[model samples]
Target chain A: MELFALSDVPEVREGDDLAAIVEDRVDLRADDVLCVASTVVSKADGRTVNLDDVTAGDRARAIAERLEAITGEAKDPRFAQVVLEESNDLVMEAPFILSETRFGHITVNAGIDRSNVPEADLLLLPEDPTGSAERLHEELGVPVVVTDTCGRPFRHGQRGVAIGWAGMPASRDWRGETDRDGRELGVTVESVVDELAAASNLLAGEGDGGTPFVVVREFDFGDHGGSDNLFREYDDDLIRQALQAWEFPG
Target chain B: MELFALSDVPEVREGDDLAAIVEDRVDLRADDVLCVASTVVSKADGRTVNLDDVTAGDRARAIAERLEAITGEAKDPRFAQVVLEESNDLVMEAPFILSETRFGHITVNAGIDRSNVPEADLLLLPEDPTGSAERLHEELGVPVVVTDTCGRPFRHGQRGVAIGWAGMPASRDWRGETDRDGRELGVTVESVVDELAAASNLLAGEGDGGTPFVVVREFDFGDHGGSDNLFREYDDDLIRQALQAWEFPG
Candidate 1:
């Protein structure tokens, strides 16, 4: 597998043609998989917010006040309001607001970006990343994975993860597959899109110097059963349940 | 960057010189990264166990009984004993044994493998994965990452992660880096090693036909501040604390 980023992708604006940009840049092969950063996707989708435009409600103000007091730093209620509006649930409250976006991706502040946007004060993640990928997949004629970088629990630093994907299954199921000795494999499924996203991150760095689009070539999925269920729901996720019942010992 | 697996790697035996095996197969480059699966590393290091030889104590037996009841399947006390001995702390006791290995990696069953081992009943993770990587790094003159595939919370499937790495820092520190707007970035760090591991897994499949060694070529670490910390300690991880205080509620 080889990954290379598209060079000199101009700043994306609202209603920009992503497929046309890629088509004009290079000839994409049938075997190639495209990994696009969510920041550009959101920017193109006009998912920007001005903190001044948001009106903080009672709950947002209350959360901001508590956050400010806990950290001994100023907190913006308007920012908290934007997070609340974008999220379906909040995973953590005090030190930082770990939120579950309306689309079910859990991350800090619902994955709202504070920097790298030249046009807006905040850049929200693409409303439906999978849908965005599908539109690109239809135009590009290849698999597309929408990538985001976020910190995960029990690990330091952020790496790329697939928030949305199209034209491919999220995982390669190895549940009943036999190992070298013909014994059943312990690893039931391998999440491929997320792995592809992480691989793309090796070429696509962060910030002003970052590349928003990456092309992965010669990555064959081979013969394997496929599954598309990536995100875990309430019952499927135990950590989320644990967090729901426990309180931070502030 | 490109990745290709070394074809026809013979089944690794105890005391096998992995660096020699790779040196024989292909020429090593200064910019190449060798990602070796921990299963092969453990096998080469004789980190295997026989279930018949293990004596399950009261703690292991009690833990096994609870697991058997919850899972409604016959559970082996000897297997539980192995997990207990390999782990430094038990993060979850019921439903499954989520353990923090002595090396600080948190995974189910301390990352023991029941499949893929031709000589033993079980294959434990490398006693010191970093040391193992360092040994390979010293001989090959290239960065080496000892990898393991495991399931994580909030995600439905497994992906590759670096349990041990040598000759390079685990993360690219973007702490004080500025974004396009010259505003300090919110993302403090980017975990590059884990991303490398995940990328390598695209070629390293999970079963009998799986390729254990993947070579990543032309990958650049670039000019960035680096940090070696990968695993999250107790205080640094809020989810770990929550799990320590909460139970499965079964």
Candidate 2:
């Protein structure tokens, strides 16, 4: 397969038709998979929230004060309020508020993005990343993946994952498939969309590198499994189970 | 950045000079990065262990029996024995053995491979993945990343991660870097090597797809941090801490 980032994607604004912008720079193909950053998708969906309008409730204020008191760093109460507002459940509140987003993603700060937005505005994850990807897939008549960056449980650095996807299987299950030696495969279900997202990161660096759209070609899959199929139910997550089992309260 | 699988990588044998083989297929360049699958690296490094020589110890036998009884599926005692031998710590043994390998990777079955090898042979992770990357870097004079497929804590399906890397920073610490909007980035230290590895998966699917070596060009990073630097200490890992704190014993 071949992967490359699209160039000249202008700074997106709320309600901007991103598919039109992408069509201007990217040559559409039936087999190509378009990987778009969640930040840009959120921007197009008007997911940006102004910190000035955010009212820090008691919990948000308490959390912010605790963070500032512990780290001796400035903590924005409004930012904390936004994080709390976006989160479905607070997993931790000490070093950072490790919370579960409404989308069931476990991320620090509830995927509240502070970069690449106007002053005092924060970009939240798209209300429905899968729906966003579907819309782009419809508009462009190609596969699309909406990606976000997050730190993993044990790994040290962040990589992009498919928060939303269309026109491709998010994962390919090889459970009973035979290996090269004709042995039944074990635990080899491959997450192709996340890999595509991560691969796109090679060009879409975390910095203001300006390139937000990535075109992936030659990815082979028999059928498309909706992106929602990739998510584990809340009760089945190992970390969430362990965290909830803890004596500490959220 | 551009990424594509190598066209002509033969079935690797033990003690083969992989860097030399890669050089024959890939055009070397100063800024280019090569992502080598751990399967190929393990095969080249003679890490393939024959199951015929392995005797299932008591613990391995017990674990295998428990798994078979639970799932009502046949379990390979010899496979379980090899996984036990290769792991540094056994994290869980229910549906499968979730162990931390000596390489500090938390994966199922200790990153063992039963595929792409002769019958009754298994491929273990390289002795030192970072060292292998460094050796390749010294010989080929290009950035190299040793990658493996792994399952994440929350996400379903597997994606590639950097098991070892050289000649480039495993992660780019962009936490203090300014974004396009001139806002300081928070928690944006990106694992670029892992991203590249994940990106490579677009071509390197887990089945008998022959594409293992991925050539990546135009990836930008300033300095090298060594792959070992990205590993979080066992004690400091959030998931490990939570898992160990569980009421159930390992």
Candidate 3:
């Protein structure tokens, strides 16, 4: 499939007519999938907080407090946990960078960023990634994905993942099918959109002039439902609990 | 890219030439990437233990004793440390599936299996996935990935991940570039092969008729080196220590 990173667009902000902006930059066909980085969308909409005035330690403390409120549980003062909770959840934490938050979402800084924002503020994830995705789908007549970078438990680096999806099938199930030899197939449900998001992120670098949104064409959707039919309402409490218990390197 | 699963080539047993079997069934070419389920490979090579006669508790105890030797650390049977240890580190642990392993590998039952084996035996992962990759690559003139099914921390179900790789680039880095608007790119490195493995696993299910291997022909590799170049000698102790101190859910 030919994947193209959407370019020549202004920075995305909150409440901005994303569909209008994308339409202006690229030709949005009926089946096209628009994958967006959540950071730009969050920044444009003013979903950020400044931390320059506060000490890093104090900033961490504030994040821990917010986490406690969200999770209804106390967290230790480890700088990583504080940063992680603020971002969403820690995907991977190490000396160089902490990959967390954005949950299954994929982007640089886990879609948490200090760059391209006011000097003192840290941008957070969009309030509702699935909602953002749905809006984009409505505007462009194509599937939409709110993406952020995520770290795999055993792997060393990060890759893009879909946080919220609309207008596309999140997963493609291939069970009970037949191979070339006509044998009954087993369990193979492909996360088609997620892999495409990761592939697009390769061109959308974290800090470069890479486009935050990518337009993927020349792909197959098969018989799966569009994004609207594929959206799932995840339990936030369960997600938070899973994050707290995720295994990461010491 | 379109993905097709290659399955049902007979139960691999000891003395079977795995590479030959794969090449005969699948149209493996020089540029293709083969994703092989590790279970079949393990079973073919006789890395299994039977436990049908023992209770689940006894089975856990027996597994724990073996793991104690491998980990060189005391384990608590009451807490399922052996299962956790087998996962290298626990990324996801629920009632039915446990995702953990030394190489950050994620798999159901910690890459352990009971089906398709003599009622008495349980399968383990291949001893050296990279080596398997290399051997397959040499024979097939394409990249090979040894993968197993793994569950995620919060997400339900399982995804296939690369446990060992050869002939392909495990990751592709897109750093120090400019976007369409000319902003400097920072930390975006795509773990392309792993994501592909995950996507391919959707069709390479863990049931009756699924092919143990998948052949992907059209991935963009760019200027990256082969998987052989990506292999690094890691300190086993560091990995063990990281697992011990890693935050895991009970």
Candidate 4:
């Protein structure tokens, strides 16, 4: 698939009609999937948090408390420990970044962020990322993704991942299909959207590049929404169940 | 960057020269970065474990013991409980994969595999993944990555990640640089190799038709080593110190 990174000329902010801004920059071809960085969306919404104003310990504690609220369980101290590690202990009063909510969906900022917001106010992830995607789809008639940066475990750095998707399929399951050698495929579902999101993030680094939107014009799935249609529902419970099933035992 | 997935090959067995086999199928350009799925590598090296042969309870206990051995601490039952919840209580045994190794990296199954391995044998991650990458670099005159599928903490599904890298710069630090708008690019260091690896993995899914090797060409790094010199001796003590600092409450 050929992927093109587009720099949306006009700046975007929360309530700025993201779909309209993107539409004005590029033609929304039916075959193209638009990948957007969440940071831009957050910035446009004026989500900004000042780290210098709070103590690191207090920030960590506050983050832990917010996590507890989202997950409906007291935060695990180990998780808090990991978050502290990722922040290098310099995060005094970090907004809760990302976590699996009580309903089981993965989200950014634990749906919380103060950076990019008007001073002293925080903007959480959209009440429903998929719903947000759907709204964009209705407006633009194309697939849309709201993405964010995430630090992976074991890996030394971070990458962009799809936090919410609409009008596109999240995965492409090829199980029961035949390979070139005619072997029945098993257990090989491809998370195509996430991969594309990561690739696009390379061009749209966290800096102020004005390149928050990525257009993927060429893909193997063709014009049909074979896999993209499956992303209609963002089921948090289903995601949680799947995660619960695959987590490694200690 | 250009990425190509190579597929429709024979099942590799123990003692196979994996690099040579892959080289035979695809021409390696000097700047091409080769990403190989750890499953195929482990399978070629005969890393596999059988679940049907052991009881699930025993498997859970074995895994817990193995985790403790690698971390040099007693396994917390609660943590174990979390793992069991994730693994669906189907774990039969722990393969005693690398733990407390020279690099201080501890992972489940020792980065081993039983899923894609031939029905009888279990596959283990290379003894030293980074060392393996280095050797491949010397032989093929290109960067090499030994990667494996890993589950994310809050996200559903798995993605391929670099467990070891050679001959390619792992990180590109763009911090301190200014954007076109003259904004300081702070903390914008990109894990370019990891992002590329994850992208290539999309075409190298875990199925029959999927290719085990992905050759990525056209990756541009200004002055970093192209493929002949990338590996370095990491200070295990320093890593341990860092881990300790992150682990213990100050």
List TM-scores of chain B, every candidate.
0.98, 0.92, 0.71, 0.67
How do these models rank on DockQ, best leading? 1, 2, 3, 4
Best by lDDT: 1
Q: What is the model-wide C-alpha lDDT for candidate 3?
A: 0.58
Q: Score residue A137 of candidate 1 by CA lDDT.
A: 98
Candidate 1 regions with alpha-carbon error over 4 angstroms: none
Q: Which 10-residue window of candidate 3 chain A scores lowest in summed lDDT?
A: A225-234
Number of the predicted model whose DockQ against the real structure is largest: 1
- Of the candidates shown, which would achieve the greatest TM-score relative to the real structure? 1
Which should have the higher DockQ, number 1 or number 3?
Answer: 1
DockQ of each: 0.84, 0.63, 0.16, 0.16
User: Of models 1 and 2, which has the larger lDDT?
Assistant: 1
Q: Estimate each model's TM-score.
A: 0.99, 0.90, 0.65, 0.65
lDDT tens digits by residue: candidate 2, B178-201: 778777775467888888888777
Residue A9 in candidate 3 has what lDDT?
Answer: 68
CA-lDDT, candidates in order: 0.91, 0.80, 0.58, 0.56
**Candidate 2 fraction of reference contacts recovered:** 0.71
Question: What are the per-residue Cα lDDT tens digits for candidate 3 across B152-247?
Answer: 433433456678888767776655544434544334456666666665554555555446777776655665333322222234322223433443
| Candidate 3 vs candidate 4, lDDT winner | 3
Q: Candidate 2: which docking quality band? A: medium
Per-residue lDDT tens digits of candidate 2, residues A65-115? 988887799999989998988888887777677888888777889888878
